[model samples]
Target: MSEKDQEVKDQELEEEVAELKDLEEQESVTDELTELTTKIDELDDQLLRARAEIANITNRNRNERELLQRYRSQDLAKKLLPAIDNLERAMATEVTDDQGMNLKKGVEMTLASLQQALKEEGIEEIPAAGETFDPNFHQGVQTVEASDDVPANTIVQVLQKGYKLHDRVLRPSMVVVAQ
Candidate 1:
């Protein structure tokens, strides 16, 4: 081959090689960019998930604190129930003379005040007499035959009063049930 022709062929081959290298470098750069973009997307998704989890935890803690605050007086109210019952029993006693009548009047006032205080604290008496008996709130110690006036599962009488604090029962009512 002639020298000039050989030189020209060599130059053409070098230019082609350079073009291939440029194309490969561009492809590598594009692949690297796509990988970086995918990594960033994954990191963003993880960040969002972590934020949602933190929000859920915060909400749960708030709800728990509210419940605790709402029922804070449960233990003390439960302890006071027997004292109120005693006062009620005292009120029920017969008084013959002036001193006895005065004492009974005082007992009635005390019982009323105690009940008011309990009501203010969200403690309340459970309704049992003449209502449908619920095992959750009433304990049937005795059973009587069902009559036309009182159906089965009805509470005939409450022997001892039941009390509750908010939605939670502090004590169940001891009752007689018609069966």
Candidate 2:
């Protein structure tokens, strides 16, 4: 071959190599772009999951707080009910002297006022006197000999009253029951 033809062939080979290199670089750029897009999609999915988890936790906490608020007064109300009962019993006593009667009447009024206040606050006495003795509501203190009128396990007297907090018995009534 002539030198001129050989030079032309060399130039043609160099041009082909350059074109191939450029195509390789373009393919690498495309691959990099695809990898970056995949990473972005993963991050978006993670962010969505995180937000949903936080929302679920927040809602759970709010529900717990509401439940606490609704039942928080139960313990306090149970503690205050006994004093109210004592006051009511004191006021109902019979007095012979004028001074004693006046004092009894005053005490009775105070007890009635306390009971009314307790009613307003959802505090109430359990009815136990002369009822059938129940271990769930009343604690039998002493067994009295049953007369013909009263059956065995009948509540002869309530020594101390029982109380309820809503539907639950807070304190069982202390009673003397018929044998």
Candidate 3:
């Protein structure tokens, strides 16, 4: 081969090699960029999921707190039910003498005050007399034959009064049902 021809061939080969190196570098950079973009998308999705979970937890806690606040007096009201029942029983008793009458009056006043306090605290008696029998509010201890005046599943009598604190039943009414 002539010297000039050999030199020209060598220069051309070096240029091709440089072009290949540049192509490889460009391909590597593109692959690296794609990988970085995919990683960023994955991290963004994870961040969104974490935020949603935190929001759900916050809402659940708020609802629980509201329920706790609304029913705060439930326990104390339930405890006072039996005492109110006793007072109601006292009110129902017959008194013949003046002293007995005075005692009865005092009992009546005491019962009234307790009932007022309960009303103020969102506690009230369940109305069972003459109403339809309900297992949710009235517990039928005994059932009587249905009469023409009273239909089946109707409450015949309330043996003991039931009370409730707000929407929750503190106690179910003990009742006789016509069946």
Candidate 4:
């Protein structure tokens, strides 16, 4: 080939090389943009999950606080049970004089009022006597031979009254079981 023809060929080859380089640079830029977009989406998803977790934790804590407040009177009502038992025992006693009878009446009214207050506060007596004995609500202090009238594991007598605060037992009834 002639010198001019060779020069023209060289110039064509150089232009093609420059075009290839431009295409490679554009592809590299597009790949970098795609990677950055993916990273942004992943970060946004993580932020949403963290916000949901925070909301759940806040709701759980609020429910716990409400439950605590609802049962706030449980301890005080439990402490007053012994005093109620004493009043009940006093009412059971026989009185001859007018003053003694009046005192007994007062005791009865006081006991009634105390029971009402406890009931309002969600404190209640656990049933024991004449019912089937349950370990959850009744504590068997003594066991007697099973009789035809009372089946095995039946509560024969309640030695001490049991009480509960709502569904939770505060004290188990001390009782005698037929077994």
Tell me the whole-model lDDT of each prediction, alpha carbons only: 0.95, 0.83, 0.94, 0.93
Ordering by TM-score: 3, 4, 1, 2
Give one digit per residue, the lDDT tens place, for model 4 in 1-31. Answer: 9999999999999999999999999999999
Instruction: Report the poorest 10 consecutive residues by lDDT, candidate 3.
Output: 83-92
Tens digit of per-residue lDDT, candidate 3, span 92-178: 899999999999999999999999999998999999999999888999999999989999999989899998888899999999999
TM-score of 1: 0.84
Clash pairs (backbone) in predicted model 2: none
Point out the higher-scoring one by lDDT: 3 or 4.
3
User: What lDDT does candidate 1 reach at residue 28?
Assistant: 100
Clash pairs for candidate 3: none
* Deviation from native of the Cα of residue 5 in model 1, angstroms: 2.5
Q: Sort by lDDT, best first.
A: 1, 3, 4, 2
Give per-model CA RMSD.
2.3, 5.0, 2.0, 2.4
lDDT of 1 by residue, 1-179 (tens): 99999999999999999999999999999999999999999999999999999999999999999999999999888889889989988887998999999999899889989999999989998999999999899999999999999999999989999998888999999999999
Index of the highest-lDDT prediction: 1
